[model samples]
Target: MVFLKILMERSRLPVKNFKEQIMSTIHDNPVVIIQGATGCGKTTQIPQYILDEFIQAGRASECNIVVTQVSLLKCVLILCARSP
Candidate 1:
């Protein structure tokens, strides 16, 4: 849990400085496009940020965040195949 807490800190992300702007933009728009260089945490961090916002606003149960990655599906299939 401590490890996750440390990782949750925005300071660790390359997008840390832009966190507020990103969240604000998301709040104001129906759709948002986030583009950044590789390892910039776009894929990993943005969804977490949106979920966090919803949680803080007491609307977590109403929030449904979906992130799709083909590689993740492949990994899940591999894990399922390996399971007894």
Candidate 2:
């Protein structure tokens, strides 16, 4: 409970510099193209950052979001099982 609350309360400050750059570009152009290597936060962090921003801006009334990973599911499942 404490851990989850801390996680939920904490902002993405570790990636502040990176987030600023990405957010600036996103603000300038509604469309963006970002490419990064595997395990990079580019896959997970950006969307959450954007969602928070949109909600704060009062523009999240009706948002249709879809998340998909091109990676193989079987391998991912096996990796998860092996992890603690």
Which candidate leads in TM-score?
1
**Model 2 pairs whose backbones collide:** none
Off by over 4 Å in 2: 2-17, 65-84
lDDT values, one for every candidate: 0.82, 0.71
Scored against the true structure, residue 5 in model 1 reaches a CA lDDT of 87
Q: What is the lDDT of candidate 2?
A: 0.71
lDDT of 1: 0.82
lDDT of 1 by residue, 15-79 (tens): 87788999999889998778777777888788888888889999999998776566786899999
Which of the numbered candidates is closest to the native, going by highest lDDT? 1
Which regions of candidate 1 deviate over 4 angstroms? 8-10, 68-84
Tens-digit per-residue lDDT, 38-69, candidate 2? 65567677787788787998988755455556
